[model samples]
Target: MNVAASGTALKRLRRSARLIVLAPGPRVLMFRYDIPGRDPFWVTAGGECEPGESFEQAARRELFEETGITAEPGEQIARTTPEFVTPEGEPVRADERYFIVRVDSPDIDTSRQTDLEQAWMNEHRWFALDELDDWHEALYPETLRSLIEEHTA
Candidate 1:
């Protein structure tokens, strides 16, 4: 879990996939971090909002932790609620906010977390946003599929 502001009350937050690296192959690159104590097995790169900070700031921090890339937040994309099952077979919902940001960095540094190790996963398994098998399963709204589809296409 990455901190939003590097302070106390670094509380747990609902998650969203802050998408960067929108490329030409109808592809949207996402960095998925592995957070312990969860089912569906992974969490996207995002965190709780910071005090007096925009959502963009928290997005950037999460991006840095998961991928080591820094980006300026761009247009708001989608809202989704990713569904997951707890280890004990209970259902939980996480509200997710999706956004577009162009990242520029030598490498994505996964150095921000001491608690969880970051891992990269493909957003769409069969193809870029095509196969429904490997879904992002957002915690917010579900418009990102279309937003990213339009952005890439």
Candidate 2:
């Protein structure tokens, strides 16, 4: 590992803001990414927080950037600290926070997705909260079900 000019190692922590967008049918927005020869996984809409941006600001920006949907950020429902390696093979510890937003429509536009996001985005769908259990245990937050129930109930 190389040290920085200040004699500090490079930071590996990434702060992200995500949203759980709910629609009129009480369904939540989710997206699936599948690669050939690998299991499919789902994720909510959001991305890394930009410099000089607050978590809420990042959530709003990413919600639009990733899904072309816009809504007011509600309660912060969950937070997690997880470490993983990026596609570029660099280790990253993610400080991810999730917020809830209810919307009237589910329409999405893909024109805004960054090249990196477009690479992994396969399809998007709206899922009924009751059916979330059938998706198994592969959701990004893993604790999503409980988080939803906590805030909505």
Q: Which candidate is the best by lDDT?
A: 2
Q: After superposition, how far is residue 125 of candidate 2 from its true place, in Å?
A: 0.8
**Candidate 2: count of backbone clashes, pairs at least 3 residues apart or interchain:** 0
Predicted structure 1: lDDT? 0.50
Candidate 2 runs further than 4 Å off = 2-11, 35-38
lDDT of all predictions: 0.50, 0.81
* Candidate 2 least-lDDT 10 residues: 84-93
TM-scores of the models, in the given order? 0.54, 0.84
lDDT by residue for model 1 over 7-120, one digit each (tens)? 633333444445444544544454433334542332335654556656667677766665666666676666666565533344546556667765333344556653434232
Displacement of residue 68 (Cα, Å) in model 1 is: 1.3
**lDDT for residue 44 in candidate 1, whole number 0-100:** 35
Specify the highest-TM-score model's number.
2
